[model samples]
Target: MTGCGRREPIVTIDGPAGAGKSSAARELARRLGFRLLDTGAMYRGLAWAVQQAGIPPEDGAPLRDLLERTTVELAGDRVLVNGRDVTAEIRTPAIGELTSVLTALDPVRDKLTPLQRALAAAGGVVLEGRDTGSVVCPDADVKFYLDADIETRARRRRGELAARGVDVGLDRVREEVLRRDRQDMARSLAPLVRPPGAVLVDSTSLGPEAVLRRLLEEVERVRCCTPP
Candidate 1:
């Protein structure tokens, strides 16, 4: 909902892995007529590049060099790195794991966080990521911390994998989700946290559409409260 003769509001969605941030952010952006900034995909694209170049996670110099040369672009639903489309390539469990580690590093966050801010500088974007609300867009007009029970989250992730034809056991997926949660919350640089004033939405019992509707309601509430 763009305001006439006023800047569009910036919305941030932050949550742990498997919490349905991606799907919610996409639909929310569509309904609001705003751009969807999937920050996780950007990190995954970088991780995929690192994996392909054979760069170890602990190696800082090489990672810095790669960051200097890399160009990550979000074109519609596709993700491109250095002019190569890696949308499908970056969604694997391996990239997810790597992305967790790489994103924790200071260099990685330092490199990407600015780009994320620049993308949303105009203020008509929906940014979704672990740190979008806490770090990337702390002053966003509206912020949401979406979450769900671990069991529900794991099952959702498993279903997503199944849809992609990459079958994985529930137990393994649950463990992976736990591990990512620990890493995301424990990381020193920009660790995941609910931003001040962010509205929390527990999706443990809510479906995607329900969560989207809730977010829309909150956004509308914020918009109505703000002076034109």
Candidate 2:
């Protein structure tokens, strides 16, 4: 479905919130032996730092200041925010809400997009985000626009949390997931969307393993078609 049909296999996995982009992309990267770049977690870490620095979520000026002083990096499964290790903190629901506000700023996106591009350009990176396929890495060798039923996505998220000892009501998680998707699609800066010729994978019926397998298979096919 990718029009660019580039020989390089970048593998941009873009989707709305709770579409399993993070977990799936991480695992897919591991299975494919590629570097995992969790773009959303980067933003989440920024939002967390923005809040921690006594900056109001709506204060673009303070948020801008935070990103400048903060050193955000992705090293395997570890996330470093402001030269500190806070990988576990960014996953909280509160950080996600703040992340939505932080990334909406043109200043923030302006700052982060370049970093994302450089990382993806480095090669064999599995990048995940709302706009990865559409804007961040439009020429990605294999662009996958992952999708799933809203209900399924919602339930799966909650289940994942429960497995980690965090209990969230299914109904609440469901509604929150839908709301976030709407927000992602509506954001003016690099909103979530499928790029032209991007392959669409609806994972409502497929588990993570099956979905990852199918993606790797497609990647192999895409690779084979390329002239060495």
Q: Which model scores highest in TM-score?
A: 1
lDDT of 1 at 60: 74
Clashing pairs in 1: none
212, model 2: CA deviation in Å? 1.5
For candidate 1, the per-residue lDDT at 122 reads 85
Give lDDT for model 2. 0.81
lDDT of 2 by residue, 106-180 (tens): 877887889998888766778988888888888888889899988888887887677767788999898888878
What tens digits encode model 1's per-residue C-alpha lDDT throughout 1-228? 333223678899999878899999999999999999999999999999899989898647898999899989999899999999999888889999999999888888888999999998887789999998889877888999999999999999999889888999999999999999999899888898988989999999998899999999988787787775
Q: What residue runs in model 1 are displaced by over 4 Å at the alpha carbon?
A: 1-6
The TM-score values for the models, in the order shown, are 0.96, 0.92
Candidate 2's TM-score: 0.92
lDDT of 1: 0.90
Clashes of each: 0, 1
Q: After superposition, how far is residue 70 of candidate 1 from its true place, in Å?
A: 0.7
After TM-score superposition, what is the CA distance of residue 158 in candidate 1 from its true location, in Å?
0.4
